[model samples]
Target: MGISKKTIRLYASAKAVITQYLYLPGSHRLNNVIKRIDKLGNSEVESGIEKVMRAFAGRHRNIEQTFLNHFSRIADQNKSSLEYFSLQKKILLGAFFTKEYSIEAAALFNPSIVPHPDQQGLKADEQRFIMSLRATGEGHISSIVFQTGIIDNMANITLDNSTGYFTPLKKRLDTSYNKLFISKRAATIPEFNRSILDNLPESFSAAEASHILNSIKPTEPSIIDSVMVFEKIMDNNYELESSSHVPLNEKVIFPISNAESMGMEDARFVKFHDGEQYCYYGTYTAYNGKHIQTHLIETTNFDVFKIRALYGAAVADKGMALFPEKVNGKYAMISRQGGEKINIMFSENLYFWKDFQILMEPRYPWEFLQVGNCGSPIKTTKGWLLLTHGVGAMRTYVISAILLDLHDPTRIVGRLDKPLIEADENEREGYVPNVVYTCGFMLHGNHLIIPYAVSDSATAFATIGLDEILRDMKL
Candidate 1:
């Protein structure tokens, strides 16, 4: 288990914190806030806006436009037309409705790494990467955030500084909905009437779905309840786009759906290579406080993301990681259903996983409490290199490795007898103590770079020679 002290260096400056702010409406008092703003004198409105812009305008892009947009949203919610208002009044009123939220004020942890889409300026041995972390704020609500960095030939890591402005994704309303998919999903609910969706075409737009739902007669309370669920289903599976002009590090994938309103936790992103096409897919757990579901996020250039719910029986539970590529002509995934043992599943459809088989169980003391894959399985010359997290005494979390037969990944090849990374004294205190975990890892020029979270409070990087890990793994 010996690894050279010179080989591993923790990048302390790589820690991620909340530098971005989101605009949210004032809770419960929105109606009152609007009424009070309407009563403000013209001179008072102008002076208030002037002071507010001087204090906050420099921190964001298009501050005036954001305010106007917020005002428009408030107007729409109150079912009012866009009445003519002085520009100064709009700015002042928008400030009243808006509040700043520090998105990652509480904790930032459980990061996953993937090769960046663009690597134009790098040297022959250098690789650019995008690391996604779960950022939790005031309510312990988590969202996905990014950091871009580069690893040179010498395995030295340098992360890019944040752009100092947070740009949230603009949800696209034009995204289409699938009728058959909704019908199948809704069938699981006993109150849902399949015939209600039978009239819609195979593929329809959101507006069309709304029309159909409104046209239905809600003669019974059960029917009304079922209609609400159907509308929520459509809303849950939608698309979002980032401003192309914004830096990748400043863009965030926040919780946008009721299914993920509680948080989007631990996204394991992988660049899947299928034939000549390369698409990035991240599987994350979507929690709505009362229920948890598996969701898939797909992006090709990182500018736009398409999110949808994963289906079938095996889709239950959290920490589901998709393989980088197909295995034996079928998509593969690593899942932990009951949170006790590691399991593997294969399916032809990326969204539907109907079955799973026990892949690995805790065989050593470090992981005797439970075991789960850290992220996606990494393809390597030796085999499919998989990183795992094992929970032991005191609920202590440690990172370990498992090697699977490349062609037949269900077959075990080698596994590390000891954890590759564990919390030392310096890393043992934070929001959660005695824990070291990651959502993914990447291989760069024979060096396996693992971006992990320390005590579920901050992030740090650890690198080790690929050969050193492969040599010590027990077959």
Candidate 2:
């Protein structure tokens, strides 16, 4: 996933190589050799001179006095040798400890911290994918590369100096198999723009920002495979503006159906000029009344796809399976994709990884294989409610709802708090485990028809009044 080498030579310089050496068994002996060299530099010559002086001294008593006075300058030499040995020992110790610390610190990738099988499938969230690791406790996400293909490209390179030739990691786009994947527009994402120049000073000019932004690849790859655009039709709580099919237009429909008892409420919808008439299912909650339980609304993906791509309702692969387009229409379900149920408001199938090999990512915590379809949905005002489900990796599932624009659903016109109900802990821990899924839903008056699959095997459901959901899914 990086650049090539030869072009690196043509680009610029590489980071300097710093030698990080380890202390070996013979290091102490090496220290001894240095000690001998010190002796040769300071002691041998002085000793030889002292021998000559003693020989030259005349009588035995004079010789004794001369020996005492000369002393072979041994005092100074002895002190220097001791200091040298102390310094040398310190140096050797420093090297040994430094290497030892590095060895210990580098063990983070050892199997204990990361325990997952090697598999390829998307997780709950739709980004930063994880790949199957070389099990045996290595890590969850690690890969090796063997193929390289690219034409001319400029990149930073390293040099040997003597030869000005550059070596580069000329990483390039997938200009292979007739693919020239590229994004021509400058990145508009504030964080991305910020990340590009994050280290730059405030004085940096827009030109500099432009340079950094354009230097790297601009488009991030899309991971999920379906999309839907919901168009709402309500102006407020009235039906006056909803007859139109345009979503997020300058116009809006009114939420004409009002439930006065709910202290506060939220309802959202999506109505596009091109959309066919569709039903809206909401997950509702009632705060002031005794109807404390919450519920989900059911709707179809065909309406979702009318205005957007098929996979707009995305999850972090682990939370929800990709709404497969291969199945299309009714088949694009969370649990019962393409199947029919005798009842419109109950559930029978809950979805899961099934076998870790079904998707394009690995299962990990950050990428914990499954999460819920929590993004509020696109709906018409009457159909303008957003519904979401929350799933614990092993213990619980809650369904929540809110209301969006009758046409422009992003307005997030409404939201719900206090999830209606959470699944039972005992019911949530099987192999395929405690789960809740809603791919299809509908609305009939104040009732939200939600058929959900639980824990991977059986499907069941409960009901919440429309007024309950309208107030809770706020913001």
Q: Give the candidate number with the greatest lDDT.
A: 1
How good is model 1 by TM-score? Answer: 0.92
**Candidate number achieving the greatest TM-score relative to the actual structure:** 1
Model 1 residue 173 lDDT score = 80
Clashes of 2: 110
Please report, in order, the local distance difference test score of every candidate based on alpha carbons: 0.84, 0.27
lDDT of 1 by residue, 1-475 (tens): 5432223222322223322223345544666776777788998888898898898777777778878887777777674553766777777777766666667778888999999999998888999999998888767788888888888998788888777777667788877778777987776567886666766778888888889878987777877787798888887788996557878887878888999998999999999999999999999999989999999999998888999888788888999999999999999999999889999999998987889999999998999999999999988888999999999999999999999999998888999998899998888998889999999999998888888898988788888889989998899
Lowest summed lDDT across 10 adjacent residues in model 2 is found at 226-235
How well does each candidate superpose onto the true structure, as a TM-score? Answer: 0.92, 0.25
Task: Supply candidate 2's per-residue lDDT for 243.
Answer: 19
lDDT of 2 at 382: 51
Clashing pairs in 1: none
